[model samples]
Target: MLQSFYLILCILGFVLPYSQFVPFLLEHGLDIKLFFEQLFANRISGFFGMDVAVSSLVLWTFVFWEGTRLKMRYLWVYVVCNLLVGVSFGLPLFLLIRQRQVEQQTD
Candidate 1:
């Protein structure tokens, strides 16, 4: 289900930071300073923006999923915590999960 998908995505997120991409960069003798500068100057904004979007989606999905199992009070707390997690990790998946739950209720 969505939960499983979320977990898998989280695992991938963790793995990506140290995966072949980093090794490939290192192998190419890329300069860390220049590379970082380029990343920040040209890519970090877009990259992190995507991260935020994705995190929001996942978070809202999780919230909605959890709402199905619990009372509103608990669900609200769950949503707040999920939002905090998303903010901390720059991921929107959790927020997205919650938004889905709200949409379900309204439907």
Candidate 2:
């Protein structure tokens, strides 16, 4: 059930953002400067960006260390998902995968 929930969230994460970004890109033609301008346009936006940036660093570090410690495959998968997808998607997805791995060990 949790896995299903996370999967749903993951799917929505991609779907919802692509819904906007695709259209924006189509209209803007890969406007990197405008992207950053909008991203850090205000203090609130900058705060959120900083929040995500810090959390991403933390998440990547955890994924790397924990993955190696557990000898887990698909470590890169988590990293890529975190980078390419949002943390809203990646963290829940990672939790789901980690839960399954732990359950397997207990069994």
Candidate 3:
């Protein structure tokens, strides 16, 4: 049940953000300056952007520390997911994988 939830979240995470971003990409064609300008265009957006930035750093740290402790391979997968999507995809994906590994160890 939990894994299913995480999988759903992963799909939603990838889809929802790209839903917004893909159109931007289509219209702008990799406008980095415009992207940042719009991202921090207002106080609320800036707040969210900063928060996500900090959260991504924290997520990366957690992925490294906990994943290494559990001896999980392919730690890069989560990071790549994060880079491609966002923390929404990466964190739950990591949690789902971690849960399976824990269950395996107990079994």
TM-score of 3: 0.96
Best by TM-score: 3
Q: Candidate 3: list runs displaced more than 4 Å.
A: none
Ten residues in sequence with the least summed lDDT for candidate 2: 85-94
RMSD of each: 8.5, 1.7, 0.7
> What tens digits encode model 2's per-residue C-alpha lDDT throughout 41-107?
9999999888988988888888788777766788878878877766766777776787677778889
- Number of backbone collisions per candidate, in order? 29, 0, 0
Q: Give the poorly placed runs of model 1, Cα more than 4 Å off.
A: 1-41, 74-86, 89-107
Instruction: Give TM-scores for every candidate, taking all chains together and pairing residue i with residue i.
Output: 0.33, 0.84, 0.96
Ranking by TM-score: 3, 2, 1
Candidate 3 global Cα RMSD: 0.7
- Candidate 1: tens digits of C-alpha lDDT, residues 1-107: 66556656655554654473477577766576754555467576659757766866766665566655633345455446444343333233443455456667789
Kindly report which residue pairs in candidate 3 clash with one another.
Answer: none
Give me candidate 1's TM-score against the actual structure. Answer: 0.33
Better of 1 and 2 by TM-score: 2
Candidate 3: residue 83 Cα off by (Å) = 1.1
TM-score for candidate 2, residues paired by index = 0.84
Pick out the ten consecutive residues of candidate 1 with the lowest summed lDDT: 84-93
